[model samples]
Target: MSEVLTTDMDRDALNNDGFRLSVISSTAVLLEQFSAVYDNYPSYLEIFSPIKCQCGKLPVNNYPESLQKQIQRLVNNITEGMETQRKPLVMQKKKPPPLKMFEPKIEEVFDDRKKRKGGSKEINEKQKLVHKYKKEMKGAIREIRKDSYMIAQVQFQEQQEKYASFFLLTLTVLLLLSMGYKIKWL
Candidate 1:
């Protein structure tokens, strides 16, 4: 129930700062009049009670009928306007693309052995090619690791050198200050 109320509030024009300001400004006069009447009769039901208005003894009795009618009209108009102005800003959900079916291509290789001869030579050659590819891949991976390690070491050395230079400069400045060299810059 609270969630529903919150969602309604979120969609309300009064929640918008600019729209709320405009509505407040437009109803300033009505609000002031309502406030004055409200001051006498704090309860909403009491304000509309005929008994309260009919009694000439009470200050609330002075409340005019026309003011009540006007307030009612203003409230009705504001609610109608709010309903008309509310437009859904949320976008519609998109439908996903249709699924596609992919069929793998099947192939048959014919060798001399399939007929009546030997195919051992071809099998040996293919195996050798596979081993050669595996070795090349391993060598490439090892070289990449070595290059990365060397780069990291170079960066570390550079950082160390920078810190060392800064330390030495600070030490020299401290030594000079301690010796009372009377340097103009110091």
Candidate 2:
């Protein structure tokens, strides 16, 4: 007979169980603390309870029966453990110091105002310079556009003149060739 070896899947299951146990312990500790606090103020439990469930049943009822039983058992164990491990709670005598809020000094406010005024003046001067440069650039662009239009017009006129001259020269040569052929000048 051969013995079966445990695989990584088994290790994973063990790891998960360990993780679940840690989570349960931590949760139980928190619940234990909350229970103590709630005992001091019974109204807290009333406020913490769910108001209504959409399913018309308690939220816990939504869980499977076995899981619910397991949860109840876990809670019971936690309560027992807490009863054994927890120490008696003590009331505090001295309260923590109240927080101090920041208030700006008069001189600091005045200094900030002075700085803002100087900064605004510089900003205004830079804006005016920018506006001036923008106007100059726009004017330059307009002049360049006009010059380009004028150059294009001149080139078009030159092209038209060349075409017209070529047409007139061809007409004259054809007329001369016809006259020579009629006079028998081959």
Candidate 3:
């Protein structure tokens, strides 16, 4: 077996085929040994049977008749114990309390009236302050708008002056050219 596995071949091919064949031969030997040991055994079925079903219950059908009956009895006893252990519910009649309207005391009402009078004065003062601030904000915004307008006017005037100067220079050049004056730069 070792000679058959270790022959001269490509390293990758040898590794794959050699490992596969060795595993297959080993599994075959194991299965043969297992079968020889259990083939004629009388309790082979009980030995190899599943201990529990897929749903986690004991495999009662796999067991002998007497054990199956005992398991059923135990299961019945456990279910009865669970049923008896539960608490019983009791029913009773209940009455809701009557509703009542809230009424303020005389002294509390007088105190609240006094607070309202003071609060009104404070509210008037706050309103006056808010009006003053609003007026100041409007004046500031107006001044900002006026300044931006003046800056825009100045920029427009500067651009107009630049174009006027350029036009005058071009006119002078054309006049000198028409008069047949040989300008050295030209």
Candidate 4:
């Protein structure tokens, strides 16, 4: 959500020391508009500006050159000012990022189907890539469903652990009380 910011863009940049630009839409038009007119790349135009909220899309690979420079400068200044933040930010925890856990790599999926001895015609390069990725995911999902025994085993083990913990707690309390009563000759 971009503010009108005085309905004046270039003028504001030239006149005022600080100017704000908010993305009105997350379309390429807004990106292109800024790219064509402003001296920045299409990517950083919105980010470099004082963005209040997401006007449309989240991020882009291409941004205005000036905007990119501004962002770089801002990041450099911040990093220089606060050297401590880099350690945790750059050298993250030992665990891999959360996203890595969910999906199997597309390459791994395709490698499993290497023995296609039957006739297989070549597909359009773009479509082949897309098809390969889709088939990989589709097959992985089907394979997961086929492993019902492993799934049931996991479920049974989870339930057993829950009951075992509950039983252990109850037995401990009983043992403590019985010992105390026996010590008093009850």
lDDT, model 4: 0.52
User: How close is every model to the real structure, measured as TM-score?
Assistant: 0.29, 0.32, 0.32, 0.21
* Candidate 2 overall lDDT versus native: 0.60
lDDT of candidate 3 vs native?
0.59
Question: Across residues 46-118, which tens digit of lDDT does each residue of candidate 1 receive?
Answer: 3434323332232323335654454455455333333433344676599777799798888987666534333
Write down the worst ten-residue block by lDDT for model 1: 51-60
Cα misplacement distance, residue 108 of candidate 4 (Å): 43
User: Which residue ranges in model 3 land beyond 4 Å of their true spot?
Assistant: 1-119, 182-186
Q: List the RMSD of every prediction in angstroms.
A: 21.2, 17.6, 19.1, 29.6
Which residue pairs clash within candidate 2? none
Model 4, 26-53: lDDT tens digits are 3333444443344333334344343313
Q: Give the TM-score (vs. native) of candidate 2.
A: 0.32
Sorted on TM-score, best first, the list reads 2, 3, 1, 4
Better of 2 and 4 by TM-score: 2
Cα-based lDDT at residue 33, candidate 3 = 52
Give the winner by lDDT: 3 or 4.
3
What TM-score does candidate 3 reach?
0.32
